[model samples]
Target: MKQNLLLFSIGIWLFSCQPGAETGSTQISEESIKTHIEVLSSDDFQGRKPFTEGEIKTVNYLVDRFKQYGLEPGNGDSYIQEVPLVELTAMPSETMTIEGNGQKVELKVLEDFVAYTEKVVEKTSLNSSELVFAGYGVVAPEYNWNDYEGLDVKGKTVVVLVNDPGFASGDSTFFKGETMTYYGRWTYKYEEAARQGAAGCLIIHETVPAGYGWSVVRNSWSGASLYLDQTGGSYQPDVLGWITRDAAIKIFEASKVDMKNYAVKSRSEDFNALSLGLSASVTVSNEINRDKSQNVIAKIAGSEAPEEYVIYSAHWDHLGIGQEIDGDSIYNGAHDNASGIATMLGIAEAIANMEKPKRTVVFLAVTAEEQGLLGSKHYAQNPVYRPAKSVANINMDGITAWGPMKDLTVVGYGQSELEDIAEDIAKGQGRYIIPDPEPGKGYFFRSDHFQFAKVGIPALYASGGYEHMTKGVDYVDSLNKVYLTSQYHRPQDEYNPETWTFDGMKLDGELLMEVGMRVANSAEWPTWKEGSEFKSIRENSMK
Candidate 1:
């Protein structure tokens, strides 16, 4: 009888150890997240920048952490994927001359607009290309509207406005309406121009429609612009740039059309192509140097299905040492992306500690996000895993430094079934999902995940709620205003534990882990929404 009891006890113990048996341990801990953020965003990291000493330290730290977690190197024999980059500083032409209506007007270079060239050659010029007013400069067959239909702009410089007409009207049906569609993006405009064989493309900037002021364009475009080496190998375009609305008005006036009339006409489909009867001449000098950066990648392969993959991404680079502001230097970028990297590391640790997932999970800390999402772009173009087999990319960027919230904000909602998984996870914790309030800003296109979306992978980036507890929307809006005016991209951005509430960071991290866990286990695969442009690409990739 004693022997029989011993056998039964052994059987019970084995049953308790079976896979999927409940263990009431927290998946990820708040302490780990706090420690990571504290260390990463601390004054010591020196604002982790690419192509600098900081980048070396940052990458090494990530690799070490991955090693500690027993994650295998994602790349062959190494965790870093090299990216070729070219830094260009286009010395401004003293003046831009517009000739039309028997009048000559010279516009000041930086005051009127900012322009650059991809031509690596020392000298580049746009010699008297005729100016064509291309309404919004968009060509979409599905929308049955083609801005280039009435005019041939083969060698002409096209002047177009930023964003789409639907933006001004806030009509959801209009070009995907209030939410900026890929059609409304500035990148699309430039690419379309290049594809159309246009000599030049200049978008007129307005704060509201562009979702940012001219200063942002000036500051962002002031530095180097990185492009893929295979992208025409330096024969991309002689001119791709932006001009202020005031300069556009000057051009309109020179064309003998009322500036207000053209502004109003900019919104309507009936707005026809107008020959400004003008020509523009610009001569620019280029300083080009090619360099290479790297993306740090680490992976935890699944046992049941190692081929299938899930990815978590965060940019590992930020603005290096820059001009001093308010007596402080070093655009620390602690909140901008250090928080993201920390969150990514924290999540990786959580997944590593848990029972092995059914599908592989990759942790990608990309570089050059501040330089126009180059690192992620390269990865998407040359993925370690088949993007088709990759289930989804859960991207974290610029996570909240402020405290926790009752809600989580998804940048692109209603665009994927992945959101349903997110909602379920949030609902389990009595949290809710909210669409980005400023959809017009195209927040979806601003981060690393955008590269994944461009190539058909379903990607999601969620941020803590901006709504405040004590002072409500006004207070939150005030803080945002301050960040926009003073901190963003400035040296004033530094980590402040006293001011920032990391509880929100922990909450966000936990929620993301939950979402990733759900996706990692499910036999189901997510897809782009029915009408999304990427749906076909995803479907084809799946096949």
Candidate 2:
């Protein structure tokens, strides 16, 4: 009864939300978003990394809030879903040796190169595997493009570019132009290499094309990584790694191959693999720790139709602590995901106080997203609810940390019908919708929503755009550049009550809240758009 009174008071406190969607209630407040960010990003939480005491604090906080908001447990009277994961800390030798053509080049680990293997083995090695430049390492039959058309890469180490040819060619008709498909992602490159029976794969990391600096590569791969337990079967290559652009250039020079000339040729349809005639050798030993992480789930059961559901998600993990900079060793991830989780929490608090919808609404705080979407992948494969009953997914990765924005940027624009719904609501708030300016980053595929989309659930991952209301576009761009270069994946992501603002995050929260609420109330389901690669998957699931 006391909790009911508090919930009633909460409903009374939050009045007059956005228009056209039950404007009488459920306000997502900036103060609310701020508090969550501050608490989660504080040093006390210890970066919220999985498999740590920090996880306990984070999970308990979420559960307490859910109970206070009067939400029901999503998974059979339990709020926690145990996701099995294996943490592997790969320790490679100090030097990666490349020898051929009377030339020997040694690349230092974490400086000129970084390597790790996902295979569940005590030790793995590349014993002088022949090096092959396999272009972008893409095999898209739909586009008549195959970088490994003729040559065999079995037992060889294939060196590939970062993004696909679309970014290089700038031809809209060819491979979706500057926008990156699944083909451009580093994950795809590694996966394709393993499929071709390659012993190792090393991606040439270019700052611009790869969308982040080499520091990001160094920071992310320099630590223990979490993968779904691979006890059943595994196809991961023995050696998966990255080489600095300078390192790649040196190797090219040693191989007598013109790096510039080959880079240009790789963008064309007729491009083929080039045997650099060089051989690479590196050995990596793994320290594997297998455990389970929790996915916090709570739901507001639908009053009318409880069978159908609408899902909202945010990742709850980040780089815990490493590579101290500026006298800070803690990676707080304030804007990276604390803002996202805060916004989602705000939405949850709002909706929990409101009347239930026609479809069950689930709030999922997934774990280990920083480790290549592993938590969400486990959820997709081992789902609590069937994909067929899932209406749509509204995802918040990193919400706006600044003040209000005039535009909301859809990461994968035109991929799903969710963008259309969001655009209409955004316009009502005097805000516009735009596509992601930096499509080469593959931001869409980087988030947890991509896992849902993989299983044919239409997902939306939109956030604050480059156009801020008070600040201009250039100001937003400059701020983003600084964050990407310095703070991203670094220990400087702590929350600052003095500088960081949450008005834009509040706006985004309210916008997506309405989207989820509307979908929950309606019987109709949103879907993938035409030309989207996931369209057929959704169609098959629906059928």
The best candidate by lDDT is: 2
Tens digits of per-residue lDDT for model 2, 1-543: 122211212211122232223534669877888889989999998899998888999999999888988999989999999998998898998999999999999999999999989887778999999999999999877677899888799999999999988887868777877889878989889989988989999999999889889998998897678888876344668899999999999999999776677768999777778999899999999998999999999999988779888999999898787678999998999987998899999999999778767789999999999888988999999899899888899999888687788888999887887777777678778987888877777888999999999899989999776888878798888888888788888898778778788878888899999888767766567878766768877888888
For model 1, residues 240-290, the per-residue Cα lDDT tens digits are 788998898888888876557665586677878767889999887877878
For model 2, give the 10-residue run with minimal summed lDDT: 4-13
Position 302, candidate 2: lDDT:
84
Q: Best TM-score goes to which candidate?
A: 1
Off by over 4 Å in 1: 1-26, 223-231, 234-236, 256-260, 263-266, 468-482
Q: What is the C-alpha RMSD of each candidate to the true structure, in Å?
A: 8.5, 7.3
Residue pairs with backbone overlap in model 1: none
lDDT (CA) for every model shown?
0.78, 0.86
- Report clash pairs, candidate 2: none
| TM value for model 2 | 0.87
- The TM-score that candidate 1 achieves is 0.90
